[model samples]
Target: MEPESYYFLEHRQDLWTFIRRNPEWYRYLTRDTERINEIDQLAKQYFGKTIPQRLEKAQHNIQLVRMLIDMAGAFRD
Candidate 1:
């Protein structure tokens, strides 16, 4: 696989593991409309595509980043 694809898959797996480990924060992180919109915009800029086509991917990345941020907080000493 290409380096980009390899890292993408690895990051996705890590996100899934983090989600499983912290189910309680999932709903809250997913429901944040403001952050979601910001992420959507960034995805559009990064991918150079319009909505609906890129909506799902954007949302997924948003959730992953949010979860990672929360996980960092929880793990920080």
Candidate 2:
């Protein structure tokens, strides 16, 4: 099956909490080295965007991934 993205309803609240608390750390943990390399190869796709905007997108992706992991753990409980 395809992996879930933003699939855990229960983790939404906690995800928001962590994001609000430490956005930078949240993003650092969620970074996709491979995709980052791809984006670096073509930053023109996201040119004119501020660092904050880029960080927000990365953070959102990270939070969604984390939420899915948390949901899987909960499911196993």
Q: Point out where model 2 deviates above 4 Å.
A: 1-48
Q: In order, what is each prediction's RMSD in angstroms?
A: 18.5, 19.7
Which pairs clash in the backbone of model 1?
A: none
Q: Write the per-residue lDDT of candidate 2 for residues 1-77, one digit (tens) a residue.
A: 11232333124554444445644533543563233334332333335255777788899999999999999999999
Report the Cα lDDT for candidate 2.
0.50
For candidate 1, which ten residues in a row score worst on lDDT?
Answer: 33-42
The CA lDDT of each predicted structure is 0.55, 0.50
The pairs that clash in candidate 2 are none
Q: Model 1, stretches more than 4 Å misplaced?
A: 1-50
TM-score of each: 0.33, 0.36
Poorest 10 consecutive residues of model 2 by lDDT? 1-10
